[model samples]
Target chain A: MQQCYGSIIRRQRHFIRCLGGDRCNNSSSDTLLLLNDNTRMQSVMSRSNPAIEADALSILRSISPTLDSTKHKGQAGKIAVVGGCREYTGAPYFSAISALKIGADLSHVICTKDAAPVIKSYSPELIVHPLLEESYSVRDEDRQSVATVVLAEVDKWMERFDCLVIGPGLGRDPFLLDCVSDIMKHARRSNVPMVIDGDGLFLVTNRLDLVSGYPLAVLTPNVNEYKRLVQKVLNCEVNDQDGPEQLLSLASSIGGVTILRKGQSDNISDGKEVRSVSIFGSPRRCGGQGDILSGSVAVFLAWARKLVDKEGHTLNPTMLGCIAGSALMRKAASLAFEDKKRSTLTTDIIECLGRSLEDICPVG
Target chain B: MQQCYGSIIRRQRHFIRCLGGDRCNNSSSDTLLLLNDNTRMQSVMSRSNPAIEADALSILRSISPTLDSTKHKGQAGKIAVVGGCREYTGAPYFSAISALKIGADLSHVICTKDAAPVIKSYSPELIVHPLLEESYSVRDEDRQSVATVVLAEVDKWMERFDCLVIGPGLGRDPFLLDCVSDIMKHARRSNVPMVIDGDGLFLVTNRLDLVSGYPLAVLTPNVNEYKRLVQKVLNCEVNDQDGPEQLLSLASSIGGVTILRKGQSDNISDGKEVRSVSIFGSPRRCGGQGDILSGSVAVFLAWARKLVDKEGHTLNPTMLGCIAGSALMRKAASLAFEDKKRSTLTTDIIECLGRSLEDICPVG
Candidate 1:
């Protein structure tokens, strides 16, 4: 049964690769079949559908810069996560902290005044800004002024950021969401890469214009989020059997903005082509994992962009970023599940991150 | 039992040297043993005790670079720490700033706003950033937006770090812990070396997957931390009688990542072999001493790694790093103990870092 599943996945992968372009068309079924002797490739096919899985580990290694002593601080990457609120501090924390763990030299969080102390109390590791305001806290008369204050505070630090991870535990507040829309606009204007997830997806779904035609925007959506995106973009229900086709249309509809659909395996597209990350993952469907994926994708996207800028267009940095991020997340999740089993939490999967990357690409 | 320990150390050192090549076999083990003898091993097994510790001082002298005017800045080392929070700010400060006093040309600390000022106030030589946030300050409705703010702050300054020590004063607040976890993931993805200690140890313990297979990661754990790690990974209790075997098992279980178990004598293993560091440590076991160890470890880890990379791999950089760090910290503590006795404080020991290092490895 597993072998049969493997064959099906192998076939699908070939099909998708063919769609990818001439680069992948020449390496067809026979070549993949010949490579199947390697247990890693065989195992990839045996479990889940490998065709949708992108070559994430390789992308991760290839994109990872060599560690050198001469480099100054922050030369690797700098990231910001715009989330964390009263009821869901863990989400923003997960996003921001993941950026740091993955090699961003700096990580920051901008949240509400109430969330600041609590988030600050969580750890002195994060720079918590208490600039955001919600409807309940602001008087109706002060709404306009408070919005200005929020944007002004954020703008002071805008140009310094390499990328921003939006939506992790972002609750739905009309006023607060409005403030975020402005922030997103400012990020776009400044040319900072933005990775949208969670409530940010909700906001972007409702107002597609916020990220439309923005090449630096990357949306990481869960099953439900993808469904909403499909409905909004394609005006139709999600067709799982034609998952790649739908995703391609949705991304192209968004004007080439990247879309990473999260699942047992992550499927990513930048309108032109589709890539899947079918690496094994833990069965533990814990919460906050999505936040990790978003944060991770944000960092990789920024790194990829930087590489593209420096290398004068050698490869697709956005696709490479997605592949690396998805693979590392899945690999870590698998390792975490091995230890925690049914009891695994999002934290367990996070701890496995370093080891997972190391397994795929050993460091010296 | 003592002979068994020696054999284990010898075999492991041999393997480490083998990882480097034939030229390193003879001098590397003897020097490493000497350094180990003067640090962790000295305190654990008394000369009259059954287990004889190796000579650690020689190792320190061997690896410690001679001070020469011909050498340029940063040749000695460079180090960074990814930690600090509102609740605790001392960890990152101690870890990064300590590298400077121990002969590193540069040291940097990446922390949240609440902790950055406090940590910076603690020392002028260190570079501190106020980035990162927790949850309470943000409204439930604005988390996604806030997370973006946080990632942007850190993303602005990722990369320029040679090695990062995560989890110093890191608090366990869900929001902050989550962010720290992400930072670890990013570091691994970037292929940077990390030394895990304090709250960082806590993060890794719960999420072993983060550092599981990342060989560049070095985890330093105290007794309770070590106990929990053994229980979680090996699924057993701590065994004193079979310390070396158990340490080996623990390291191997984690897929070859280095583990430095802090006790009277520090035991280190990379799942290959167990080595002991017995050096000149004070009888006084004071609070905040671990901070010194962490900082020292960061410097030595960087230096050892530099040697490995530059000299074509003389030994397992991780192992050599542990040995050198354990020895230096012990020597400094012993030196401080002679002056302050029972009143010895962590700060006093920190003050002795330069002198102790100079005594062992003079730069003249």
Candidate 2:
């Protein structure tokens, strides 16, 4: 109950700051960090929803901060990718590295024992943990103990992560998926944001209760994956006609978990409103592109959530993150494709990410 | 579909206001739309194709947009090339990328699922959809369901496109051709213009009902393809002595669908008249030039259609599109040949599309 009122108080403080009350400062002293005067809190609570749409640009600009020397390492973001098994290592590495490239201060990859060394060898910048146990590695008798151990290890650092990207190269090992479910439940309890993609989508579709009604959950599905999702959630075939409206229904049905439907164009919705980012990216249907997208989204989402905690931006932070991530991913893919043509690989696109973000939102 | 018409109306208003009409302020109130005295529409319909022989320079000058900060994304045009397959990725890539370099704001490629990745690898500027299917990929039992899926995928994007350049590198697969036929029917219903070339000519030559009387359908066939069309429609051998008259009859035979007959001097007709674009060109007969011409024609046709919607341009938009496309393509080829001589390839000419257009139609 105290947690509920703390969030409200945060909102009240954000409202005061947004309205230019000038009662707040950059001090992080208060227990709940209320910088402004308390007089506006009652009036703000009296009203229902006080959301206004900025012309789109300002909302994004505000979400992405102007970094300075005053900022610390973790202040920008600490992102984690929770997927990697014996069968796959590249997927988690692509996703984790993408978060760092997109401006996240720290990127961590949680994977199984066999996958950890390979993923770590890909980049020294990544913090790889071999905490997950796949079915082949663990006997059925020890499954319960193993799950408890994995969760305890993850819980130790769960609060430090701004966002967790689930299901990069996460293979479909029954034991692994079951443990991930427990982690998801714990993350939900702590209210950590998640951007689910690839094999992670497979896990979520079957275990809807894991993410159902979780506002901070985001699902990025490819063309085929999206078809399956529509079939399962809407209990009907994917309606190509009225796609935007259908997407809205799907998100609402999932309790407003943001869905970024990846296709010829990207359409995003968080149940309340449908937004799309049609900034043409490279046409390469190469693998690993979606991993890049999930990681980029993780970083952007963390930043937007921070903005929501401090400022009174009414737009859904998940939707905004999807939009920014999609646009930057596409712009970078386009730039990579321009130079390399068909030879443009996911690594090449990853190489272009830093310049691409700088091009879109200049630090200066 | 409404958005397509709304864009035309916006272009009409912009064109009128640009011409110093003082007629419609930027009120966005559309009740005043049909109130433009009905003068332009009447003049356009009464002239009977008015083949007044617009000069080469003027045709291109009016076709290309004058680049400025005032322009919106699709204000220039949005073009899509409905082609590309396992055997033919480069053709669609050349066509779609040419549209972008020629100043179309957006360019897209719709190709077979196998071809999508390859074509996407070519450039990031084009939005590539892996929506098409092939005969080998589909089982006889799944044909119906697959066709429906293909059409639905294309339909969702049909209205957003200003023009579709069909058959650049489209293989002669029966299943793919059948699905494309359905797409043509859908595009005709939506009033989206199409420029047919390469294998598209082969498809329509056998299935005239696909284009039949659709006024916006553009069939751009080479000398050999034009001969087949003439033999199928007119039931006679080519009459070289009276090429223009024969071309006019072929277009008339197809109920006035625009036909751009390629040769040393490009001939265009829409049943009522024959218009020719004569420009000096390179002796190097290279492939992919036709793809560039077809893509260019699609963009020019969309722009010319907007001009007709406002300025009462008497010549059919398809004819103007062909004239402008043919002139610009030949000039670009000539410029590339001038520098590279015998070594000039299709890529060289594509590289010159922007400079060639600017030379003829300066932004200032």
Which candidate leads the pack in lDDT? 2
Worst 10 residues of 2 chain B by lDDT: B44-53
- Provide the TM-score for each candidate, comma-separated: 0.54, 0.55
Candidate 1 chain B, poorest ten consecutive residues by summed lDDT: B43-52
- What's model 2's overall lDDT? 0.79
Per-residue C-alpha lDDT of model 2 across residues B125-225, encoded as one tens digit per residue: 45677789999999999999999999998998899899999999999999999999999999999999999999999999999999998999999999899
In candidate 1, stretches whose alpha carbon ends up further than 4 angstroms from where it belongs are A1-20, A26-52, A308-315, B1-364
The model with the greatest DockQ is 2
Report the C-alpha displacement of residue A284, candidate 2, in angstroms: 21
| lDDT (10s digit) by residue, model 2, range A200-296 | 8999999899999999999999877888999999999887655766787898899989999886557787887665555557654545788899999
True-contact fraction in model 2 equals 0.00
- The residue-level lDDT of candidate 2 at B9 comes to 58
How would the docking of model 1 be graded? incorrect
TM-score of 1: 0.54
